[model samples]
Structures are given as C-alpha cells and as structure tokens.
Target: MAATAPSQSAPLAALSSTATELDVRDMVEALGAALTDAGIDGDLRGSITLAVSEALNNVTEHGYAGRAPGEVHMVVDLLADRVLVTLSDSGHGMPGGALPPGLLPDSSGARADLPEGGFGWFLIHKLCLDLSHTRHAGRNTLRMTFPRYLAPEKS
Candidate 1:
C-alpha cells in the first residue's frame, strides 16, 4: 500500500501533553469528540479511540520508556470519508525494520506464549481503517485513519 505524507492542514484538535496513561485517555476523548462533531459516527469514533490509545501507549511505554519527559503530539483531521489522526513523539525510535506484526494469531487450539509483545499493533490494524508508522530524526510518527461508517445510533 502506498503511504501518504504527513498532513499539513491544521487538525480539528491538536493536543500536546506529557506521555502518561491518563493523558492518553484525555487525548482520545478530545479527538473522538472533534471527529463526532465533524459528523463521524460512534463506531468510527470508538475505533479511532482505540487506535489512538495504542499509538500513544507505544510511545509512552516503548518510545520514551516513561522515564524522561517527552512531548506527545496528537492531531485529528476530518476528511471527506474518513478521520485521520497523526501522533508524533520525540523519543527513541524502534529498532530499524522492527515493524509491528500485522494481525493477531488465531487462538483456536493454539496456545501461544503471551510474553512476546506485539498485540498493540495487531489491535490497531484491526480497529482502524489504516495505520502507518515512520521514524525520522529520532521522532516516531504514527498515522491512523478511520473510515466513516454509519453506526446503529445514526440509523
């Protein structure tokens, strides 16, 4: 799949906060509200929230290791048929070529060890329309997109 460049347009809501679990929830709520106000449905909103949470958690846990104070930048864009959220952080980048796994393995009759970590990426991929990650100049950028879908609430 072709990757698009980072958006230059102003986000509906841009939040900069210290990488913390509480801050992640606040950012998700703020972004979800902005998208909903822009006419996105609740289902999409939930998906977007999950994707954003996963991205932010990755930055807080792996990127910064929750040690030093680092900035987590979140931007939400309302598009014609989708909502896009881009999260950027200035922290240690993932090891070169260490992309997250695409999907979770089937659990039926398969008992896999849970110690190996990669489930966040799997969940992000499953929840959002599309996700792209990039690291440049020690900054990690994650873009998550949610397609506009009419939820039961709208019907």
Candidate 2:
C-alpha cells in the first residue's frame, strides 16, 4: 500500500521521553491503546506494536550507546487504510548515517548457535509498507507505514 497521511485532524497518539527501556515500553503501550481506539485489532495491531518496539529498542541500545540517554519521540497516525509511525531521537544516527539494508540474517545453523539479535531492521522492513530514515543536526528520525490489516471489532 502507498504511504498515506492520516485524514483526521490529529494524530492517534504522540509521546516523548528520555530514551529508556521503560519509556519505550510505555510509549509502545500508548500506541497500542491508540490503535485499539481506532478499531485496529489482531495481527495488524501486534505487527505495529512489534515494529515500534524494535525501533524504540534500537534507540535504547544503539542510538544511546556509550553515553547518557537522550530524548526520543514517537507519533502515530491512523490513515484510512494504513498506520504511520514516526520515531525520532537526539542520539546517534544510524551507522554510516543511513538506514541499514535490512538483509535477513543467516539462520541455517544450529538453534543454539543462531544469532541472538540483528533482526530489528529486517523485521521493520518486512512489516512496514514503507520506511525511511533521516539524520540532521544531531538527531535521527525514522518514518514507517504499515497496511491496516483491519479485523472487525468484536461485539
């Protein structure tokens, strides 16, 4: 699906906080609530939550590496047919100052020897219909959109 802007006058949710695990969790929960309020449910909601969590976890782990955590912001907008999420932080830009290629990791080895991580960008790329990143003036911004897999609201 094409990345479309929200038709509504306001975003479904927005949050800002110091880049920390707890703060990330809270912000993601807030997004989940907003999605629920917008009548999104089932796997789409879970996919959005997971993608946002991975993005936020990246901020906590890599963005703030070797220094005090900085501020992070998340804005969620519900379009008629998709959801847009923008996450920004005043920390390190992506390695090499660009978004990763998001190549899937090698998983052909033994289960015990598989990589413990390195799937964040890959999953984000897979889940989002569109994704982009930018770095300017000591800040990084990631924008992504996911198709609304919309399930009917249960009575």
Clash pairs, model 1 backbone? none
lDDT per residue as tens, model 2, 1-155? 67654464588888998889998899889888888898887888988898889999999999999999999999887776778899999888888878888777999999998987899988887778889999889889899888876531222
Clashes of each: 0, 0
Once model 2 is optimally superposed onto the true structure by TM-score, how far is the C-alpha of residue 45 displaced, in angstroms?
Answer: 0.2
By TM-score, how accurate is candidate 1? 0.78
* Winner by lDDT: 2
lDDT (Cα, tens digit) per residue for candidate 1, span 63-88: 88757858899977867667778889
lDDT of each: 0.74, 0.85
List CA RMSD, all candidates.
6.5, 5.8
Q: Provide the global lDDT of candidate 1 against the true structure.
A: 0.74
Please give the RMSD of candidate 2 to the true structure. 5.8
